[model samples]
Target: MLWLVPLFLLALRAVQAWSPTDSYAPGNVSCADDISLVREASGLSPNETAWLEKRDAYTKQALREFLDGATANFSNSSLVDSLWSADKIPRVAMAFSGGGYRAMLSGAGMISAFDNRTNGSTEHGLGGLLQGATYLAGLSGGNWLVGSLAWNNWTSVQHVIDTRGKDDELWDISNSIVNPGGINILSSASRWDQISDAVEAKQDAGFNTSLADVWGRALAYNFFPTLSKGGDGYTWSTLRDADVFKNGEMPFPISVADGRYPGTQIVDLNSTLFEFNPFEMGSWDPSLNAFTDVKYLGTNARNGTPVTKGQCVAGFDNTGFVIGTSSTLFNQFLLQLNTTSVSSFLKGIIGDFLKDLSEDYDDIAIYNPNPFRETEFVESNYTKGIVNSENLFLVDGGEDGENIPFVPLIQKERDVDVIFALDNSADTDEYWPAGLSLISTYERQFGAQGKDIAFPYVPDFDTFINEGLNQKPVFFGCDASNTTGLSYTPPLIVYMPNNRQSYNSNTSTFKMSYSSSQRMKMFQNGFEAVTRNNLTDDSSFRGCVACAVLRRKQESQNMTLPQECAKCFQDYCWNGKISNKTAKVSTIENYSGSISFITDSASADAASSTAAASSSGTSTSKKNAAASLPSSNSLKWYVAFASLLGMAIGLM
Candidate 1:
C-alpha cells in the first residue's frame, strides 16, 4: 500500500503534465550573413582583452581592501601601496580541482573564505581575494561550483548556504542524483521524467547523446533547481549577456574538458585540453590550436569557415551539456541504472539509449557536426583521428590527470602572476590528493603538447607526501630562476590541498550524497583550510598569500621582496627538497581541524571528547584534530543507509 502511493502519484502526474521544454536541441541562428565564428587560437581573444580592461577598474577597490587586510602585520606596509600606485597590481587566478560533490562543497567554502560578502570573511578570513582575482577555472565537480555561481549572476556563498533545503532551492543532495526527491516524493518522479525527456529531445534532433547527458540533467536538479526546466534553456555562452558579467562584477570563468577520439579507452597526459569560457570553446595545445564562437557550436565548419553558406547553428552550447562534457566521469553513475531505485519507465529510456553507445567509453560527449572538421590550421598539428572526423568526442577534464584546471591560467597570454590551486582530488584509496595533478602538469611542460605552455616544476608523488606538501598549503615556483627552457615564467602555484580539517572531509569521491549537516561541515572545513583556521595556525598566512600574489610584479619592477615578505616566503614556500621514501596514506579518517561550530551529534561528541582530552593534558593541536567525527542526529537513519550504500559502491 505504501509503495502504491508513488505509482499512483506518478501516473496522475504523467497525465496532468507535459514534458518540460528546454534548449537542449540545436537551433538555427542569424549569423549576420558573412560573420565567421571560428578563429585561430593565436592569443587572447579580443572579447577577453576588452573584458580585462573592465575588470582592471573593478578590481582596484577590491585589491586595495585585500592588500590592506593582508599587510596588517608589516611595518613598511606603505611600500606596498606605493608599489600598487605605480601600476603594479597583482593578477590572481584560482583553480578548483575535481572530486565529485566533495570538490563542489569544499570549493564553495574556499570561495566563501576568499569572498568579501561572506560574513566575517573580510575581518577574519581571506575575504576580497575572490573579488580581486582576475580569473576562475574549474573542472568536473569544481565546474558545478563555478557554474552555480556564474549562472546565478555571481551569487554569494552565503546566499547558497542560507537556502540549502528549501523547496526549489539548490544543494538538496539528501536523495542523491539517483533518487533526487529529497523529502518530496512528487518532485523525484517529475525530475526523472524531465531528464529522460531532455535527453530524448537531443537524440530526436539528430545529436548523439550519452550517459553524460543523463548525468548533467541530474546535476541540474541539485544545482539549478529554481530556473526554468532546471536551467535547461541556459547556455554557457549566454553568461556574457548577463548584466553583472558585462559590468565586470565577476571574475572571468573557464571550464575544461579533454578531447578523446572514437574508441579511445584512455586519455593520457598528452591529450588535448579544451577550455570553455564565455566567448569561446577550444584548446591552446598544439594539436588543435583553434577556437569557435561557443554560442554557435553546433554549426558545421571547415578550415574556420561555415560548411553551409550563410547558415549557422545556435543553442548547442547548452549550459548543462557543456558542464556535462567536463564532468563526464560521472557517466559511471548512469551506468548503474539497473541498480538504482529509479522508476522502470525512466530507467528504460536511459538504459535503452545507453545500450547503443560504446559501453567502454560511455563517458564521452559526442559533438556531432564537429566544429573543427577539416580545419587546416587544426590539422597541421593533428593528433590521431580528430581533424577528419565528423564528430568530436570530449571527456572529463581530469581524465588526463591534470584535475586542478591550471592549464588555462598558465597560458602566457593571460599574464596571470599567481594561482591558488584548490585541490580536492581523490587520488588515494581513502580519497585525498597527493599533488599528483601538479606533477602531471609539470611533466607536460617537457612534451610537444606543452608547446608554448609553461608550468611550475613539481616533484614526484613520493616527495609530495613524505615532505608534507599534500597536507598544508605550500608555494611552488617561488623562485623564477628555478624554471628554464620556457618562453615565459609560469605563475607561482599556491597549493592548498584538502587535508584533515574540522571534519574528515576525505569522504569517498563516489559518495553521491551528503546530509545538510555533513555538507555544512565540509564547507566549514574548507573555509577553515583556506583561512588556516582564521590565521590561528599562522598569523602570517594572509601576509604570505599577499606576498605570493605580488611576487612576479615585484620582480618585474626590480623591487626587492619586503623583509616580511621574504620571511613569509622562507616559511611557506617549498625549498626544493626531494625524498626517496615511499609515500604513506594521506587521509586521516578523523576530525583534526579546529572546531568552529557544533551543528550535529558528531560535533557534539567531538566537543565532549575535546573537553575530556583537555583535562587529560592533551595538546591543543591534537585536540582539534581528534574532535571532528562527522554525522548528523537528524539523519542517523540515512547515515546508516549511506554507509551500507558506500560499502556496496566500494565493492562494486
Candidate 2:
C-alpha cells in the first residue's frame, strides 16, 4: 500500500506522454498530426486554431521528453525513502486525508472541468479554470484513464471562446465553439450557491456522488437558465423547468449561454470518463422534519420564504436558513462543503472509535490463528458439552481488578495443583528455562500453600497426559530438546493433572467437565496475567504454555473422575504420610460414619488414636486433605475405593 515517490514519478512521467486531448476525439494518428487535423476542422476560428497550435507544441515537447526517459532524472528516490522511513509513517495519514477530499469533490457534480466567463466581457473566470487544472494535475498515473477522470481543465482556446462578449458579432460563433449545442451551462450565480451547499454536505459523509447526482443537478439547471426566467432567481426553478428537464436527455436548446457541451445527450455526457455522480439526498419525512434544528443550512432566512419552485426555507442555523429542495444540486453542494477539517474536528471530540475495533480484531486473530481449531471448538460446544461447563468466576484479588483465581475443574473446591511437564525434545534448547516462572506465579498467588501444588516436568505428551492426569491443576513446560532425546510434536499436552488420561489413550477417558465460558474466563484472568508478566521478561513461550494449559483442561473433561469414596481414598493413600490405621479410620468414617465395623480391638484402638491426632491438627489437616491426595491409578481397586471415600468426606 505504501508507494515510493520514485514509482509515482515514473507513473506520472508515463501519464504525461498520454494524449493531452480527449481520446474519444476522431484521432487515428499520432500527437503530431492530431493538432493539424484539429486546426483544419471547419468549425474552429482563427484565434482558436492558433491557441490550439501553441498548446499542442508545448504538450508535444513535454510528452517527448517524458517518453525519452528524461523525467527519470527528476525521480527522487531519496525523498521516497525518507517518506517510507519508520518515522514518516504519519505521512500516510496525510495522503489519506487528501484522498478523502478528492473523493468528496468527485461525489459532487462540481468535479467537471469547465471555463466560466462573464457575459459581454473579456475577463475569464480563471479561478474556476485553475480549480479544474488542479483537479486534472491530481489525476495523473492512469487515475483519469481508468474511469476516474472526475475533473479536467478546459483548453486555452475554449477559455477565450467562452469569455467572448455577447454584443460582439463573434459572440454567437464563440458560443458555438464553447457550448456546441450539446451540454448547456446555466448562467446564474445563485443556482451555483445552492449546488455548492448540497455538495458540501455529501462530502462530510465520505460518500462519492454517482452519475445520478450530476444528471439530477443538470436537469434542475436546464429548467431556469437565467434569473430573469424564474421567481426569486432560486436554483430550484431550473429543476422544476418543464421545457428542459427530462429523464433521459437535456431538453433545452444549447447556445452560447451553455458553454462547450461534452455530449449530444445527458446520457452521453454521463457515460463519458469525466462523469461524476452527485450525492442523493433521498426523501425527507415530515415526522423527521421536526428534528431539523439550528444545524440545518440557511436557518436565518425569512419565514415561509420559497428559495425556488418545489424548494423552500425549512429552518435556519447560524450560517443560513435550511432550504429544502427536490433537486440533487442541493445534495451535491452538501457533498462538496463537507470538509475533512470538520470531520477531523468531530473525530477529536469523539476520540478514535476505530482504535478499539482494530484492537479487537487483532486480539481475535492472535487468539484464534487456526480457523479449523476454532471450528473444532464450536463443534465441541455442540457435541461434547464439555466446553459449555467451564464457568468464569471473577475473583477479587484486591489489586483493583488485577487478581484472578485459576482453579482446575478437578480442584474446583480446593486449591490449584499445577504440574509443569517440560518438553526436553530435540527441537528445544537446553538454555530455555522450563516452567520456572509459571511455578513462581503459582507461589505468588497461593504463597507457601502453593508448594503442595504438583508440577511434573515431562519431555512428551504421553507421560504428561497419561501419567500426570490425576495431578489436578498441573502445568507442563516442554520444548524440543536434543539433550533429552525428545522430538517435537503437537498437541504437546503440556499442562495437565496427573490423573487425567492421555488424548490418544483408548482406555483413559477424560473426566473434567469445565465449560468453554469458564475456560475463557479462567484463561482471560489467569493466563492473560501470566502472559503480561512474561511479556515484561521478554518471554516467547507464553502463547505455547497458555495453549497447553487450555488443551490439558479440555482433555481432562473426557476422562472420568473417581465416582466413589473408596476409589478416591485409595488414590490419595500414597500421596501423604498417613498411617494405615488413620487411612482405614478415615475410609470407614467416610462410608459408614463409625468404627463399629472393625472386627479387631487393636485396629479400633489405632483408629481412635489416629483420629485424636488428626483432630489436634485440624487446621493442617484441612489444608493437607486435598493437597496430600495422590494421583489416581485404576490398578489399586481397594485403595482407590478407600481414597475415593476419604476424598468424599474430605470434600465435605
Candidate 3:
C-alpha cells in the first residue's frame, strides 16, 4: 500500500493548480526605471543598510527577551540593558552546511529549536536566537532550507512539520526527484514534460540551459507545493517585494555559489565565491569587486550598466534556477541513470543532454549574457577570465571544500559578532563529520582568496576528531587579540557538528527518500543534538550560547566575561591542544555532566532501563547504534549501498 502512493499520486489529479508559462524565461526589457540598480561591491548596498537600521530595533528587543529567560544563570542581569543602550550591539548569524536532504531536514530541526515561535523550544533550548540573528547564509542543500523558509513568507519550520504526511504538502519527499510527481498529482512522465518545457522555454528564448534548471524545477515541487505551477512563476528577486522582508521582520537570506570555467574538473580555494541576496548578486572578492541588479540578471552589462542603451533583460533569474545554481554539483544523477526507475524515453533524452554536458562540465549552471562582461575592475588571476567571458558558469558552493557558508557572514561591512555554524557534512567513513570543512576554510584565509578577510586559527582535522570537537559545540575565535595579520576581526564561530543524541542522525547525504518515521526521528535527533539533550548533559549550554553572542560586544567595551560564562568558555573553547593520533571521538567529559533538574527522573530512568532491556533482546543488526562507529552488518550494508547511490545521484 505504501509503495503504491507514489504511483497513485502520479496517475491521478484532483486539481489543476498549475500550467506551463513563459514567466520564468528571460526576456528583453527596459532599463530606464532606475539608474542605481547596479553598483560597485564597495560595501553593503543601500537597501540592505537601510533594512538593517530597522532590524536593529527588532534584534535588540529579541535579545533582551531571550537573555531574560537565562537571567538565573547570569551574574549580571542588567547587562542586557547596558549592552542595548551602548553604541555597539551584539550581531549574530547562523550558517547551515550542505549535504542534500540531510542538511535541509537537520537544519530545519535546528531552526525549530532556535525559534521561540515553536512551541516548547524555549523550555531548555536556545530559542529566540533566530529572531536576533542579522544574517542567514546557506550553500547547496543549506540554501534549500533557508530559501524555502524565506520565500514562504518567512514561515516557521513547525508549520512545515505540521503539514507532513498529507498529499501534496510541503516536505513530502515521498517520491525522489528522478521520479518527481506531487502537488498536482501528475505522472512522472508528466512532471518531466513540465520540467522539459520550462528548460526548453529558457533555451528557446536564446539563453543557455543546463541540468541546474531541471534540478531546481524538481526541487520547487517539494518546496513550494501550494504555489501556482509549483512556483514556476516565482522568481528569487521577488522576495524583495515581500512584506516580511521589506519590513525587516526576518533576517536577510543569502544563497552562495562558486564560479568555474568550462572544463575545469577541480574547484579550489581560490575560486571566486558569489552571493545572491534579495537586492543583488555579486562577489566581494577583489577580482571582480562589483555587483549588479539581481532582478535584471540576464542583461548584458559593461561597467555596471546595460550594454544597450535603455534596454535590459528580466525574468531570467528564476527562483528555482538561482537555488539550483548553488547546487549544480548534483548533476551526478546522470551517473546513476540505470539505478533509477525513470522511463526509457525520458532516460534517453537525459542521456543525450548529459553527453553534450559532459563535453564541457556536467556540474554547472549556465548564465548567458554575462552581467560583468568588460566591467572595469582590477585585473588579476581571477578577474581576467571572468570579465572576458561571454557566459558565466556557476557551480556548487561547497565544490571548493568550504561546505559551510561562512564567507558572507564574516565580511567587515556586515559586522557579525558571532556565527552558529551548523555542520552536517559527512566527512568520515561512518557518515560523521571530521571537521575537514572547517580546516579547508581555515586554510583558505592565508591564500589570495582571503584578501580582506581573516579567519581564526584552527587545528588540523586530526585534532578535531581526537579532541571531540566534532561531537559537540566548540568555540573558535574567542580571543580577538590572538588573531594577527588580518584586516578585520573575525566573528566567534560556535561550531556545532551533527552527532548522536536521542537518535543516530548520521544518515548518508545521498539517501534521498525517507519514511515519515525516519524523517520525524531525524528532526527529533537534531533538536536533541543542538540542545545537548535538553541541557541534561550540561545545563550551561543556553548560558554559553548567550555568552558567545555577547563575546565581541563585551570585549569591545573592555568588559570581563560573566562568572558562569567564563567557566563555560573555559570548557567549550579549544585550548590549542593537538594530537598526532588518528581521528576518533574523545571520551573526556569537558564539563560536569549532571542532570540536576529532576523534571522526570522516573521517566528518564524508565527510558534508559527499557532501552537497555530492548537492546539485549533484539538483534544488534537492527538496533540503533548509539555508539559512533558502525558495528553491525546492516550499517555496513547501508554504507556500501549509500556509496553506490551517492555515485549514482551525487546530490548536494
Candidate 4:
C-alpha cells in the first residue's frame, strides 16, 4: 500500500508547499503568506557584521597556523606572525568559475586540498587555507559546490562525497534528474508532477514562469536529492539559520548570476553581475546599487524601496531555485523536450506553454516586479534598449564570459588581499582556460564606471598561451605599487587554470552528465593541480603560494621583496607584454584523464565520452549563452492549461 504513494500523489493537486500567487497576493494586496521580514536596504547587515566578528576569531587562528608554517622558508620568517593584527592580516577569498559539473567537482577537489579533513590534504597541502578565508564565491557549476556545502551545514567536500548513498546520495551523479536511479521511493511521474505544479503555483501567483522554473526544479532534485520530496520546503534563506553559517564557521557563500536585459543576445563584462548571499540578493554594481532581504525577494519593490503597494512574499528563494537561477543555461535541457525522456503529452504541454516565450527564449530566472524597477540598471524606464520589459532577468554567471568569479571578490569594501581563482572555464580549442576570463575582467575595468576598481594587467589571449602562462600557475597583481591601471590596490590573483597534468579536467562546458568515477578523477586532478600533487610535480608551487599570500603585507609595510618572491614574480607574473597575433590555440588530443582506481564501467564510458568531445569546441565558440524566452501573456489558455496540465502530466 505504501508503494502506491507515487500513483496517489499524481491523482490529486496534492497538499503542497506555497499558495498560488493569485491567492497568495491578489489585485490590491501582495502574497497572503507574506513573511514579516520585509525587504530593507543596508550594507553588510548587522547580522553579517556580527557573524564576521566571531568568524574572524576562528580565521585568525587558522591563518596563524597556515601562513606562519607556509611562509617560514621566506626571508621574512615572521611576516605572517608580525601581521597577525586584525586588519593587517591578509584577507583571502577563493573563487570558483563556471563549467557545468566539471567546474563543481574540480572545484571540490581543489577546495579539498585546503581541507585538512581530506586524506593527505594537510601534508604539504594548503589544508587550513579555506578556514582562514573571508569569502567563497561560485557561478553556475561552482554554485553547486558553494551551495551544496552551505546547505549541508558547511561539511567538507570529501564528507559530501563519502556520504552519498548512505544519506540519500546527495551528489550521486548516477541518477539523472528525469530518472532518479532508484535513490528515492517516488516514481519519475510523481517527481515531475510535483515540481511542475510548484512552478505552476508561482505562475498562478501572477508571475510568469518558464522552462527555467522547471529546469531549476529539476536541478533542485539533483543537488538536494536527500529531501523528502526533492527538497519541497527547502528555501535558500533557510540557510541563514544553519548554525555554521549564522555563526560564521565557514566562508560566506556567494552565488552569482548575470543580469540580462530582456531579449539581449549576450552579456559583456559590463553586464550587471547579481549575487545571492545568505542575507540578500542584489548586485553591488551601481547599475542597481541596492539589495533586498533574501527572504523577501518576491516582494514588489520600487527602485530599492519596498512599497506598501506590493505585499512581501517569502520562500521564493528556494535553495534549488537560487542555484538553478545561477545555472539557468541548463534550461537548454528542458527546451529539448522532444528528445527528453518525458512523455509527449508533457512535452507538448511544455512546448505549448513555452511557445510564446520561445520567440525570445533566453534561459533566465525572472525576479518579478523588478526589485530594481526604476533604477538605472533596469532600463525599463528607457524605451530604446529593451525589447521586452521584465524585472530581474538573471542568467548564467559566465554568460558574459567573465568566468573567473572576480565580480564578488574584487569589491572595494570586501578588501580581499589575494584571491585564489580556480579557473575551470573551457576557453580554448583544447577546452582548457587560456586566461580569457581574466582578460574580460581587465577589459571591463577600463570602462568609465569600472575604472575605479583596479585589476592586474594581463597580456593578450595569444600571450596567455604562447608564454606558457596558462600551462602553469601564474600570478597577477604581484606588484601592487607598480601597477598602472588602478585607483586602489586590487587583490593578487593566483590563477590555476584547468590543465592536463593529473587528469585533463577540461571537460566540455555544455557537458552535464558525468560518471561517478570521472567525477572523482576530476576532483583528484583538481587536487593535484592545486597542490601540484602535494608539491611532488612542482615543490616550488608551495613556496610560491606562501609568497603570493604574504605579498600584500610586505607591500603595506614597504618591506623589501624577498629573494624567493623576486624569483617567483619573475617566473610567474605577466610582464606587461602584449601579443595580439592569432593564437595557435592549444588542444588536448585523444587525452585520457581516466582514473584506473575505480572499476565502474560507467566511468569508462564517461571517459570515452569526455575524450571524444575534448576537441570539438569550447564555450567561447558557442551561441550566445544568454538566449531569451518569451513571457508575453499572449496565450490565455497557457495559464489554465498549465494549471491543470501540469498536475495531470504524470497520468498521461
In model 2, which runs have C-alpha deviations exceeding 4 angstroms? 1-60, 63-163, 166-329, 332-652
- Give the whole-model CA lDDT for all candidates, comma-separated: 0.72, 0.19, 0.71, 0.65
Residue 518 accuracy (lDDT) in model 2: 28
TM-score of each: 0.83, 0.14, 0.83, 0.78
**Model 1, C-alpha of 222: deviation from truth (Å):** 1.4
- Two-way lDDT contest, 1 vs 3, winner: 1
Error of 1 at 223 (Å): 1.4
Q: Write down the RMSD of all candidates, one decimal each.
A: 13.6, 36.2, 13.4, 10.6
10 residues in a row with least lDDT, candidate 3: 590-599
The 10 consecutive residues of candidate 2 with the worst lDDT sum are 90-99
lDDT of 2 by residue, 1-652 (tens): 1213322333243332222211101111122211111111122234323433443333333322222221133322132223223222110000000111111111111111111222211121111221111011111101111111111111122322342342311112111111212234443233433444443343232322222222223222322122121111222112212211212111111000000011111111001011011111100111010111111122111111212323312111100000111111111112222211234454343223223322222101010010011112123222122112111011001111000111110112111112222111111011111222222222222222222222222222122123332233233322212112111111222231111111111110001112223222322222222222223432322222222322322233332211231232233212212122321111101111111111122332343333333323322100101111111122123122222322222221
> Which residue ranges in model 3 land beyond 4 Å of their true spot?
1-22, 33-37, 182-186, 331-356, 584-652
Top candidate (lDDT): 1
- Which regions of candidate 1 are displaced past 4 Å? 1-22, 182-186, 331-361, 379-381, 586-652
lDDT of 4 by residue, 613-645 (tens): 331222121122243346544333433343344
Clashing pairs in 3: 100-652
